[model samples]
Target: MNKIFIIEDDVRIREELSTFLNRYGYESLFSINFENIIEEALKEKPSIILLDINLPYFDGYYICREIRKHSDVPIIVVTSRDSDMDELMSINLGADDFITKPYNTQILLARISSILKRVYGVSRGEILEYRGIIYNMAMSEVTFNNNSLELTKNESRILNILINNNGKIVSRDEIMKTLWQEAEFVDDNTLTVNVNRLRRKLEDLGAINYIQTKRGQGYILI
Candidate 1:
């Protein structure tokens, strides 16, 4: 079954979309926790995401970018902002398609079906493989040399951030935010613990110490 993660603050729109998606044989998951939108998205591993531009804790653009880091799951932006620039900006941020608000439900469903077919149906699978490791961004499942490896939520988040960067530096603050969202009571030690767990997993897989710590800088997937 395909899961569709809907991240819109408007309760009315959320309900309508969820209902429509269910009718189409999709499992639609809606989020009320604005602060944890991205975290929920990662956990759900939806087949496609319907994101709104304006959100409570953080905007949809940030969430889209965060999701892009670890998964290539199709992101079809469904927002109220209809300006040409808004559409262009969304595309630049890696959105697969952008549909402005006040749109027909049928049209929205059509766009979603199209994106899903293009990304999942046309392609053979949803997981991205690198160095014999399969990273299933949708299910957040990872397998090393064909064996399923268990990973904590935080550990999966770390891998998602690093793999998305693809040899780029991801700052510690960014990682912290991705994990903790708007919680004001996050401790540095918590992040430290997550990173340690992720490193151990990678080491067990014989992956080079590719996740490097830049003293005072941030972590990077080298």
Candidate 2:
């Protein structure tokens, strides 16, 4: 069973989410120790995390940033802060997804399910190779010229789509729809951020010029 780590400080909300997720066959784990949340999360190593922006001691942004420094565990920022800046900051800090407070339970559940599947549902030893660069889906890392680098959930997903459609231009709309089934909830800018980040990673991995912009069409793996 996939373990979901809940990081909301509200006892009632936490309990509700835990119960709801449990009904969906997910193992829910949480800690009331708000101050040491980062430590708790890293130690537990859950499949995914539901993090609230507001907390007792350290905020979710700090916890998220700290966690990304150590692990690529998928984190969904669940908060009442629905401002564009808040969502952008969460995404910039490496959150896999974001949902506001008083959100529809079904939508939240769907987002959780989507992220978990993208992050951890790949078959063992599954990989895609293009121009000598290898993307290992199961490991969420890319190997090129004997160098290996881990990828965040979103980065890996974006790369996966590009590699599968090699030599073709994939429109932004299609990529966004594939990444988040409900594209309306996702900001158009978010996709740009993820694609740019992925491009940088690829460049660092010595796959420079592998992904090229089609100038209004979208991106293509050349």
Candidate 3:
């Protein structure tokens, strides 16, 4: 799972963001020590950051600039400062994205997903490892022990979501939405077929019962 470092001083907002992100399978990390914010962030080595402008000690812009000097981690400025200048300054100081306060949480999720995809999805041979199975996303293949099986596009996506969320029960709706993000119509039966095929492929590689269905809920990767 990806770790998101939050730099908001408001305790309630920080806790809320952490809970929301956690529900979506992300690990959230934060600190109340505003004085060593930069150092703490660098040490944590988070996949991304959610920064607040109105902070104690040093503001977010300075932290963003200083962090930029050391690392290229994606930063999204989330603050109440809705002025054009705030957005522009955030961009100028190396923020990858900006969102004003009282924002829609769904939009925030989308922006974070977009930035993460852009930053991490460009590698030539990206692979996800879980429970001794290696999923080579670039080549659409899953390897276990010495056996390997090729997967179709739909099967690959379904497996990707399951493996990313690992032990969690991923809803059928969420899987369909990810598989067909731009489609006007989605067939429920199609997802079942793809998931069944993926499970069969895993079985072929000796990964028996890797995916378990939770009755009317969804599927979990065990």
**Residues 161-197 of candidate 2: C-alpha lDDT, one tens digit per residue:** 9988999999988999899988889998898999899
Off by over 4 Å in 1: 122-222
lDDT of 1 by residue, 1-222 (tens): 788899999888899778877865689998798887788887888888888999998898888888899788889888888989988988898999999878755445546655776777732224444554556554566666445567778888888788778677888889988988953579877887888877777778777586788888789876
Candidate 3 per-residue C-alpha lDDT over 121-179 given as tens digits, one digit per residue, 9 for 90 to 100: 63223556677677767668888765788999999998999998999999988898899
Q: Which predicted model would earn the best TM-score?
A: 3
Which should have the higher TM-score, number 1 or number 3? 3
Candidate 1: 10-residue stretch with minimal lDDT? 122-131
Clashes of each: 1, 0, 0
Order by TM-score, highest first: 3, 2, 1
With a 3 Å backbone cut-off (N, CA, C), the pairs that clash in candidate 2 are none
Worst 10 residues of 3 by lDDT: 121-130
Q: Model 3: clashing residue pairs?
A: none
**How much is the lDDT of residue 139 in candidate 2?**
66
